[model samples]
Target: MGLFPISVTVVEPGRARTGFRKTAAMRLGSDVGPHGGTPIGGLRAYLANPAAEPPG
Candidate 1:
């Protein structure tokens, strides 16, 4: 088994417009998983931005 490195980033609009509340945005690293990494909570982030390249 190998261990890979992953990162998570969170972005927020910090403002409301058009009578709508702005929600926070989140971003994750490209390399986010091991050979069989199973990120339970991270599923959303991973889905938001799937990795296009393999870890070096």
Candidate 2:
């Protein structure tokens, strides 16, 4: 992957139950997660609504 496609996610220090691993596991694949195809769709979706459950 190119540098342009890479992204960084920042989490607040000392936050509890942040679900960092769940968000990190999300793939940027066309058929993966709720917001599919688009680049970094999972992060975008999570940011939009953190309380929303991730697609299994």
Candidate 3:
């Protein structure tokens, strides 16, 4: 048995600056508690142009 078109690559990410944690807290109807993460916007860049070459 073989899986077609299956590729997995590991990525070393820097400090995560997403507000995912904060958003989850709000979903529970709780006050923001010492949130300290910035929006890295890395995904946004890729979404803008999937075929474009990555910036150096």
User: Total clashing residue pairs per candidate?
Assistant: 0, 0, 1
Give the per-residue lDDT digits (tens) of candidate 3, residues 1-56: 47787879999975544555445434544322343132424333333443543433
Best by TM-score: 3
Q: Which number leads on lDDT? A: 2
- CA-lDDT, candidates in order: 0.40, 0.56, 0.44
- The sequence of per-residue lDDT tens digits that candidate 1 reaches over residues 5-39 is 76779998543333111121134333455632555
Better of 1 and 2 by TM-score: 2
- Which portions of model 3 miss their true places by more than 4 Å? 1-9, 31-56
Kindly list the per-residue Cα lDDT of model 2 for residues 1-56, writing each as its tens digit.
88688889997865445566455645332244654656666555555565665554
**Candidate 2 off by > 4 Å:** 1-13, 16-35, 50-56
Q: Model 2's lDDT to the true fold? A: 0.56
Clashing pairs in 2: none
Error of 3 at 31 (Å): 9.8
lDDT accuracy of residue 34 in candidate 3? 41
* RMSD vs true structure, all candidates: 19.6, 15.4, 13.1
Give the candidates in order of lDDT, highest first: 2, 3, 1
Residue 21 in candidate 1, Cα distance off native in Å? 9.3
